[model samples]
Target chain A: MATAPQLPTTRPLWARSPFYFNSTAHLLRIGRGKANNLQELLEALRLCPDSSIFRHTFQTLEEHHFIKEGFSNDFSHWAFAACNEVELAERLAIIDVREFTSIATLRDRLVLIIEEYLQKNPRAATRTAMEPFYLMDSDLVVVPTPYVARNLEEFADGLHKISIHSIYYHFIDARLRLKLNNNDFSIWLEKELDLAQAADRINRIDIYTSTLEGVRQNILKIIEIELATPDSAGPD
Target chain B: MKDKNPDRKTAVEEKNAEKNSKARDPKQQQEPATPAGQAAPQELAVPAAPSGTRERRFRQTDLPARVIERRKHPRISMEQPLPPAPPCLDDYVSIIGQPELDEIRFLARRLRGKTVKMVNSTAVGGGVAEILNRLIPLMNELEVPTRWDVITGGNDFYEVTKGFHNALHGGEYNLTQQIKDIFMSYSEQTRQRMEFTEDLFIIHDPQPVGLVHSKSQERGKWIWRCHMDLSNAHQGVWDFLKPMIEQYDAAVFSAPAFACQLPIPQYLFYPSIDPLSEKNRELPEEYINKVCDDFGIDRSRPVITQISRFDRLKDPVGVIEAYKLVKKYVDCQLVLAGGGATDDPEGAVVLQEVIEAAGDDPDVIILNLPPWSALEINALQRASTVIVQKSLKEGFGLTVTEGLWKEKPVVAGAVGGIPMQIIHKLTGVLVHSVEGCAYQIRYLLTHPEFATQLGKNGKEHAKENFLITVNLKRWLVLFQILLGMAKPNATI
Candidate 1:
């Protein structure tokens, strides 16, 4: 028997561990997990081609397979399929960066990526093409036991407290504080993001000493704000 | 050989000798025979006017009737049609990419409600004029309400300004009191004769740098946009002009290094090309072929051409040296075609020198055309197998951008904004010397594949960076920033 799904208590709603779990579960129920490798998974998903996101991934995976094949003298149909895949991959790969390795990294990367994608692709909101999912609600479980009504008001109060705790880390200051002990990685992210943001702020960047220091301070302020957010919020 | 036909051979030899002697010194008169047919004694005679003055006359007036009839057809000049007054920016930006569109909108907001009037000497025949002719319309399309005005002057004023130009470019010039007075007198006359609105006024180049004094308290946003390389300008000239320049709200230069330590804020804006313009737009193979045929340039042999004003800074003479070096490896011809600007007095003398240096070489064609010769320049560039711009000093050579847009690989001097356009060995080859230019030309001629690659990359780069659409977008954003309608965005 399969184990029940569990939600992490310390992340934001969008960054929670259960989000991708729910999405993959839907794909698994649809027989997508029968795929033995990334290539197979891409091909299987391509059969239905549910969302533009899925379509983009399928195309990239197909190109990865072709490059690995190294120009085999296959039939025209096979060659053309690879050609189409490579073309699509080339177009989408322009936006691809390093993949996330940890759940926290994934949460951060996904939110940023989705926000940028939405900004660029406003029409995507109108398209009802993205996949949806249903999470398992264990509270609905029917157990063979007598119901006990003990401290109902106390239960509601605890519920409210837990809700606030779940969201406290979402603020930038909270993330900075949590990652303070991991200074190198936090500093690296802060520096990179500050540079990118500052670059987008000015018409032309002055590479003077003052401007460089100003960029550093600007990003550090964002980190400070992250660190000061109430613990009731979730991770950034 | 069996004894030469004595009478026939001597007759031919005598005729050849006469022809050679006449050609040898056409500037001298033929020796007159004495009355008694005796060898005339060499007489110490008074110098007479040049005998070839008749030959030196402009030949355009002496064309045959048929040729004259052809002229009646009303030839299309560089000024013809004027590119249909450029379409509104809305139609252009709508199809442009988002980043580019946003850039235009941002610029539009900054420049909104501002009327910028750019005044330059000579509305044609020079780089500054050619650029303004295109730039002004585009600025207006962005709703900046820009206008271009040309200052008129007589020969004395032009001669003085030409000295000023050379002096500002570090040439050893004595900016005497007479020259200063002459320049000032012309400026004062222009100020009195012309109408200037109380808007953002820009005076371009040293020719009109003194126009700042004409500005009144009501005048807004006075900018002196200098296009010449002033890094090593004569201190005397700069000192004379400094006080008037500081009166402006800001100064604009093509390069940061060209900016002086003026009290006013300095903005560095590189000149750009309009890709959609006739001079730059892609021409079909048939049209390119026709242009070459029409120009009397044979496409069979490699054609190396330099299209620039007859100014010495462009170094048309150096271009010849580079072409000669390349010609040693491959059979090619050189074409130097350009005209004089109204404000540039040295162009005529320099053009005469260029022609003399070129000699009677059939491969060297020097066309001293009028200012309105854009199509001919376009045809020559399109027909060129290799285009070179060997400038001793330049303020962003637009010819490089023009050649690149046409997908013709250029070998240009790595000065000013040239490097900004030609990525060495990529979009085009940027050389520092005539020898380097020659070597690059030879390489491109030898490696057809590399030439094609460079041309393609250059075309794409021009489309992305220097199109009229991009220029208009920049103006719009600049206006927005100036008007306080929007803050300028820093690009990463």
Candidate 2:
């Protein structure tokens, strides 16, 4: 596995709702604590005097193994809803059943697909099963699932680039469906920005993306740069 | 987009202002349209009187003739204190188990020194307040410093917030600048007057959402706990409130789909009921009998009860309509009992509409009890053969949980948090409309064996999911994750 350089200063993915996870990370960093395992994380949180429902709910999930615990005892970097098939199925059943239809369907398909694929090519099926869902766009190819961030810095830098790719794909899809030319980008972009000024429109987009990803990319016209590609194979 | 329709906007604004004034001033109000869609008796426009006055008026209007006569005859003084409630700890422990006890200890160990404060709009009538009344004491017993606070405002604030609530539910209600100004002024006043020293600040619902803006010098984790279902929120309202919501340290929603693409990590917590509370606790047979007699409910006829605030969304009239439909085959009485929260100004009108819809039908009883009438609620639920929650839109019907906990099979709206409890053919039945609700109600009444099984299954499910003991453990784990104490080997 290759790791990126340092954590980026800004992340577009994070800016969407930076407070929850960002504050949790910041709080973990504050107490001079290194929590790798579920137990250790519980130990650190137990130190906090306030009985916040958020912390309590997480602890319950860990105890029940609804989420998968990390390999390291220091749980600074953790995954969201980390779990296995049985528990995942239980969680899935409880979900609102409205959103994530594709993901839900894919999960259902995976069981059958893996079985069939294995019958055809056992070696490849086994290898693919071991590998996670690495993000694959239409043009640019990334090795890791989503974007691989060696550290937080790269994670932040690639946030907007990745998002811009998604945005452009959506824009182009709508444009093609409506039989509109690519020239409609400026009008749509202005409407999206909801601003009077055109000069700093991309900057405003970067801010919007930052809220989603927790940090922003360094490149300002990263949307234009990423828009060179036609489409993406996976969700943003 | 709004700038394009200024004239239309003003017209709607004028209509709302007229409605609001009529709601506030009894003199300007007329009787609500009856069940047949005709004008009915003119109800006095009371300035949304407090619980005491409202209770007196309700007793005068709705209480059984015998009960009223008895009251006048002075058999027992209204001031006579009721007997002390029975010891509930043993029973609570027997059902919910010892983990609750251990979790409380651990919670005390963690939060003993810190203060946890809860802020909401209403203190006496709403579900949040009801839960807090029991929960705060339990927290204190466990040695965690806990306090509950009620945000104060006049009618204008509540009326504006009610509009915001409807808007959040995708209702096409546009609020004016004047209403916005009133809301801001109240928020500002509350921010100045409120003492914000707690380690954890929990603000519930849209009424106090702006309180996060008040956080100046003291910076702690501010959680905006939304109790409503936001899946279909009106775009205009969501767009307006999203920025304010973003300011919170974290956002907590009742269901997963209720969560949006906020940068904050959203936690899904199903609201729960305390089995130990007066409203939820089991009542004696005599008390149940007395309540049944007082409410003019026939003990022989299979009784169906839906206890909820008389809001349009609860569909009280729709509930009666369902009961009437069901009554065509089997003889069953319906009890629609609940009081309005202080914040919902439209409750009285809705209640009146329900009363008129019920008509002179002796079997259909509409009881708008006071907020503190816990024993009455318990009696009603106990006396009920079937419980129905016919809500058009619901966040979580705590009444359903309460009814299920009391071992009554329920037919509820398949919306919001209700589905989180009623598991179709398993625990209880979930219905979408009046016809569906009536079908389920009829099914339960016809099949006594199946109804009993459903009631038993519902109680078991309630024990597993909607109990406060389970809620306490969930909170414990969420805290552990925040403190970075989750097991490294554990997977979610």
Candidate 3:
């Protein structure tokens, strides 16, 4: 009779609210800060608004998503394309945006990279760019789409159908907006569904290697895999 | 349908009734019909009210009512019976896909009940009018009430505005006090005549930039939409116009490089083309062959074409030079075809120069097609082996967009907004000189597969970026931001 103790039953953790999908539209505007040379660029990097930094980094991915091979951020592209600073461009491009959650930290990293490069090569600071870097930012309007996902199955379907802009809003843009080190999908997957492994797989998606559409496909694949497991389902 | 201007309709109806009554009665017929405060029709001694005086009086008293009439029913601007229904939001789903259309609908849904009015210089000739012709209907279809009005001006006013247009495109022009006065006088007249009652007013280009002076008295947000390149604008012209531009709540440019430093925010909006329109719609092969035969274009030989106005800024002469260079290596025929606009007084002069540069080459065909020959132009573009847009200065190089949308390999100048459309061998080729353009043309001719790939890529780029749906979405987003229904989260 005392051979086995009663074991607790495994239960699911469900979210209080469904995840409402949202798409973002941008109203791009010229920012006050601009730069003609590496010195001015560094100064602008320090003084430009946080939104400008976000635009040059995160929004750039969406803007130039069609291009297969290029720098992922505007600063690197400008450094290489405008200033012909190959080493500097490489360094700037290597500063992954996903490594930081906030724009302030991103700005610090950008400033630090440029400052270090300038300290070593003093003449590079005065090197003039072919075209000036115009700091630009956008007014982000998040619109709620009709797509809503209450569980993993619905999320998989939503991923298959949502616009690329919605994917961008949730995956890359939410990190800065929500001050999370991970994307919206991963956070929701972990916090609501208690699916940490699937969430970690989604977070590991390489943004630089893929387009927004590519990212959507990868996310869909991960979600589909999770949905295939018997334990993926929650209580009816 | 409800009558938009009931008062004017009533007046017209009363005048008609009085005339009918006079015709019915012998005594009344004997008495000359007279306006309420004017002399009778039989009073020849009054010298006919000094030519336009009576008409001017009628206009001044009832101008606002007429404007309201035009705004409520856009068909009044044309004075024609209502035509067939225009392509709605669903019509665009075929071109831009369902998701894109859904996004536009979502944004437009948030902008419901917001009224928009677009003011420009012309209603017949240029790209702005053509856009509004299609855009207004689509916006109304989305439940966003939109109207378009063309500001009227005399030849003197138009001449000054043309000069300003050139200057803003980086050409030299003297901005004298007389010119400024002329522009302001016409602007003031237009402001008085038109009623600005919409929730958002988009005043396009510098001709109506002065209309923003009425913004303080009006109850709406004003936007100055500059469709020209202002990167190297003449300082004096920009100085004269800057104050008025600053009065707007925002400014929109066709490209980012065209924006200038200003206190108000500036937006980047690429001018778009309707894919389902006559100029861009797909055609039958037999019809294309007939169009080519009508234009004396040989279908057997390779045809390289450039479709744009014969303006010096478009560099039609440079295009001919490039064609000549390419002709040395590749035995291809070159077609330079375009139409003139009412606003461009210099078109004839440039067309003459282009003809001279062509120098009686039988292979070089220059057709001065009328503006209504959109289908012919479309046929010519579709029949082309390669498309070239060699402009020294361009606004947005929409011709390049058109060619790319037609899925023809394009070689465009690396100036203004051309670079935005042609991504240097990715979407299409970008060249800086006549020699470079010629070299690319020759290269594309030799490597047919590469050219085909470029065309495919170019079409996809145009589809993704420069469609009318994209333009509609941007506009709705801007309206939402202006109405304070959506906050622009600029800062983290």
* Best candidate (score: TM-score): 3
Q: Residues B235-295, candidate 1, lDDT per residue (tens digit)?
A: 9989988988899876667655565677765654567775534465344556555545434
Top lDDT: which candidate number? 3
- Candidate 3 off by > 4 Å: A1-16, A115-128, A233-236, B1-85, B170-182, B216-218, B284-286, B289-303, B320-333, B340-366, B442-457
Report the lDDT tens digits of candidate 3 across residue range B1-492: 211111213432344345445544556553221111223222112111112111111112222454333222222111211111235567565677777788888888878898988888776546786787678778888899887777878899889988998898788998889999999999999889888788999988889888887785537999998887788999999999998898899999887888899999888788998886667866667767766765567777789999988788888999999999988888888888886632345776777677678774656777765544666778889999999998887778888999999989999888778777776666898887999999999999999998997898788788877888778888998988877788888426
Tens digits of per-residue lDDT, candidate 2, B1-492, equal 111011213433344345445644567653321112223323323333323222222223554677444322212112211222222233456565443444335544654666666788875445676566556655555565667777889988888899888888778887667877898899999899788877667789889988888664554567787888786787876776788888877777776546666766566567888775557755557767766666666677788998988788888889998998999999877888887733365887777677678765656776765554676788889888999998887777788898889989999987667766775655688787788888889999999898987788688668756777656545544454443444311111
Clashes in model 3: which pairs? Answer: none
Best by DockQ: 3
- TM-scores for the candidates: 0.53, 0.55, 0.80
DockQ of 1: 0.02
What's the lDDT for all of these models? 0.52, 0.54, 0.77
- Give lDDT: candidate 2, residue A225: 42
RMSD vs true structure, all candidates? 25.8, 24.0, 13.5
After superposition, the stretches of candidate 2 with alpha carbons farther than 4 Å from their true spots are A1-236, B1-91, B149-163, B172-197, B213-219, B234-237, B339-361, B487-489
